[model samples]
Target: PIPNSYWATPLLLACEYPWTPANPNKPKLDAVLHAGVRTFIDLTENGELRPYNGEVLATRAEFLGIDRQAIEYHRFPIHDRSLPESIEFMYSLMEVLRDNERRGRITAVHCRGGIGRTGMVIGCWLVESGRARNGEEALAIIAQKWKTVAKCNKYPHSPETGAQAEFVLHFE
Candidate 1:
């Protein structure tokens, strides 16, 4: 988990959905509740969920005993490297984060692997929140944070693609 000191109040998390076959025994729901996460922003598209080979996110959350009413779930599907639409979705995501922070709720953002689209959205948030002057700066901060998380978690974590990096660098 990213340390709370990295950002202001109402922590925002970018991670992969936890109910994968490779990690069947992971106590993800318990971890989320323990971390005080009250909001989930799912960046995976419906089509990706259906034809793909993974458990449904909402079903997994429900199975983990998450209260549907207690946590807000926002689904904003962003195709890789799609500019204008991705930018629009980022605005909506920022709005949700703003609202959740106002209510003192911790927010979690997730995609399939939690590096591509997730990183993009976070970079956008950093810029939108005035923590960074531009997309490149935002990405730099994200890269630093990703390195920290990857080291702490003992996993490979970073933005997934050159296109994703470019998207962050050019995001408005």
Candidate 2:
């Protein structure tokens, strides 16, 4: 378990396996290790890495000795199970990134298919990193990067309830 910082938890929650093969692609594993991935974040609220059981696969990767210290799990309860929960998860991700930036650690974030939940987290990253001006811009950038669809608002706005995007835009 990693330290319980405002940031770390969200990152763990941001964990998703979008591009990686269902059972840890060998080539991808090489690239991940090369990238200095100190930890793996699991952001799914259900905490179940569907399709291929991410937890089991990651544990196997650990057994194989691929920087096992980097694997960490963070879980957030998805009470709403709707748009609001999705947005809340993104805020948690922002905290994790901020904390990591301060500690100088590089992390990879993902969700199920790396689309809906995954896109939200990356959108927060763009805004927090100042790569985008606002949530709208952040959404656009994420969509471009991952080709995701975040259709919460009539347009592609961040979820309205979490107040996370609004809060992070000012603070970060």
Candidate 3:
């Protein structure tokens, strides 16, 4: 793992968008290539990541290769501060995370700033992976590790919004 990396699981990490605009705000996969992230699970939409004028909405995801030709890069573009639009998509995302870990792939999951959206998915994973007994425990673990980072979605909770929290709470 990298120095400032945050882990959702030993193999799965939570991070902000791994790219910035300053380096032309492009996808900088090489920057984190040393982290040995064989897989990247990006939970951001196209516009949500990438370089911007005001600031570079970056993440610490182990490594995200939007390069398309990389060994692995999976994107699930849910809106910020929100849950996945569909239950099926959410299931698929969780399945991928679980599968990647089981396969021993060092996977990374990221969203804008690695806060609300990141916390939501990672919290769900904590339950899904059996790291926590339930969503409440999962949220507590994430909130403790992230501290102030968990308040972005208008809630002092890991999943940020009610819908997100509920989704994680009832996640299968």
Candidate 1's displacement at residue 53, Å, is 17
Q: lDDT per residue, candidate 3, 38-95, as tens digits?
A: 6777887877645321112123332253333334777888898888888788779889
Tell me the number of clashing residue pairs for each predicted model. 0, 10, 6
* Model 2's TM-score against the true structure: 0.55
Q: lDDT (0-100) at residue 169 of candidate 2?
A: 40
User: Of 2 and 3, which scores higher on TM-score?
Assistant: 3
Task: Work out the TM-score per prediction.
Answer: 0.73, 0.55, 0.74
Ranking by TM-score: 3, 1, 2
Across 35-58, the per-residue lDDT of candidate 1 in tens digits comes to 767677878877765321223444
| Alpha-carbon local distance difference test for all models | 0.65, 0.46, 0.67
Tell me the lDDT of model 2 at 28.
45
* Best model number under lDDT: 3
Lowest lDDT block of 10, candidate 3: 53-62
Candidate 3 accuracy as lDDT = 0.67
